[model samples]
Target: MSAAAHPREREIAADLRLRAARPPVARLSRKVLLVGTATACVAIAGAVAYAMAARPGAASRPELYAVGGPPPERLAALPADYAAAPKLGPPLPGDLGKPILAAGAPAPTMGAAPSASPEQQRLVQEGEAARTSRLFANEAELRADPSPSNVGGEPVVGQGARAVLDGPVDRRTVSPDRLSAPASPYLLQAGSVIPAALVSGIRSDLPGQVLGQVTQDVFDSVTGRFLLIPQGSKLIGLYDSQIANGQRRVLLAWTRLILPNGKSLVLEKLPAGDAAGYAGLEDQVDRHWGALFGAATLSTILGVGAELGAGYRDSAILRALRLGTSDTFNQVGQQAVGRALSIPPTLTIRPGMPVRVLVAKDLVLEPYSG
Candidate 1:
């Protein structure tokens, strides 16, 4: 029994040694080990590559933000801070409602921040996400200061102001509704007639007030208002009688008066109103003024100096080409009150514009009693 068992054990051990020493078994084990090592290395490398590539795009995105300038209404406009902004409307009573302050409230509690409303949060989020989004093109910081040549000029410190003039309905003219201004309005038609006959013929026998004096210039309150009485002042409108407490509120843009002494007067006043309104009116004036006064009757009849007698007036730089018998003014007059026998009428262009015009007074020439 012992001998048989021993022989079998010896044979089994020999067979095991033979299998371990075989070339194919050892070669196959080596190949298997190499493939397993390569697979482990690839898996490890791929995980690390993914983590590295994702860091900035993921974690740093929230911290990346662009700094921008303050909004337009805030540009150098008075009362920079909201608190300093001028209070419009009726003044608040001495006592306003109490603003109950929470003594120890957290600066930033969970869920939502106290300082920002939902709308504000949306704007902030939009601005923060703008670089990657299509809301506005990408922006980058450009320092205007800490430069060499910028110091000498009106250096824009940080980001300077910007104004855009593009929009629908160019905001550069007095639209029809603007002329009837709130305070005072003037009607304007470029060279309309002055009704001299109407003014002279319809004589009012009412008490007449003498304006100019023959004496030397001094302060006189004759018309119950201030009056400067010099020949030079009289030639011009140095004295204005409040002709009824200025209830007659029309601003004359320009006028021409051929005084008895043969002096021409050309006066122009500015259009006054809201900033937007003034800008619009100025734009319209620049666009249409030359075309306007070019063919009116007043341009013709007020007749150029060349057509008048020796002492004829009307000498102004604006009137450089104005002295032709048929000027832009006379045609306007003819168009206004047609030919021959006519009553007195007046034409005026006022400071305010409504794209149209309105007139409250008439002009008629009157002969002085000698």
Candidate 2:
């Protein structure tokens, strides 16, 4: 017998017959699907191709690359202007090249113009001459003693120039050796003192007299190391008398100090006034007065009290006698007080007393040889 037709086979045949009998819609659908799939694949491939082309190492845009990249083998040569120098305007005017000057401006000078006046110029010339002269003199002195035993013997240009230019040696720059054996006048400081002794006796009433002789050397006030006045210098003064509190006091007014170098200088009074022995006499009198007054007052009080007590109990005659005794004691007390308060005589200054005097002004003295 023939195999019975399978159910699946029958269904397959039916589906094939239905598909064959239908319109071309299924084939069209398949074609549409295939076209869509092909379109999507084409779009994906275009995107990938674009990404690879846009990568970092990819070439720039065609226009920029063509201009910036190396020239092509057939490139044309550049124009002549590329190698030519730039054109410039005409040169500045000759007058414009010079510096402009304002009206009334002084003419240009080769160098700084002389600013010194005639007198100043003369002085400068004189100073220059003096400096040159001193320089030559110093050179000569140096040559004369190329190996001089004493280097100090060389004359200093500055010192000599100062002497010539200023008309006198500058005492400030004077060497100690030169000052020690001074041949020029030297100024002494203020407040310097010379010990002196009275040459003759002088009383408070005396007016003018020679005072004394300097017995000791004196030094300069500025440079206390330098000797200013030597021994045996003369001192002259006036005995100035004044009346104070009805007492005459005398002061030795120094007038002149004759230095041993034969130079005379006005002298001032010593800074320390008269010695203690000459002061305070009036104070002593006042003390005496105070003591006497105190004693007298006490005595008077005691005498009056005693008289009153005696008179109260005594008869008239005895009372009178007691009063008289009291009066006598009171009178004695008054007399003692008056005597104590009396002004004493003025102090008298005698000559031959040692004294010190100061230089009135700056004194220029030469060194004494004796």
Query: In terms of lDDT, which candidate is strongest?
Result: 2
Kindly list the per-residue Cα lDDT of model 2 for residues 117-194, writing each as its tens digit: 999999978865654442223555665555534477877657756546745346686556633543334566554555
Task: Please provide TM-scores, in order, for all candidate models, with all chains considered together.
Answer: 0.13, 0.30
How far does residue 296 in candidate 1 sit from its true spot (Å)? 47
Model 2 lDDT on a 0 to 1 scale: 0.60
Misplaced by over 4 Å in model 1 are 1-41, 45-256, 259-360, 366-370
Give the alpha carbon lDDT tens digit for every residue of 105-224 in model 1. Answer: 233546854687889989978864653333222223223223345556785654343212221347667656544432212222222212111111111112221122122222222221
Native-referenced Cα lDDT, model 1: 0.36
Alpha-carbon lDDT, every model: 0.36, 0.60
Residue pairs clashing, model 2: none
Worst 10 residues of 2 by lDDT: 278-287
Which residue ranges in model 2 land beyond 4 Å of their true spot?
1-185, 246-249, 268-346
Q: Give the least accurate 10-residue stretch of model 1, judged by summed lDDT.
A: 195-204
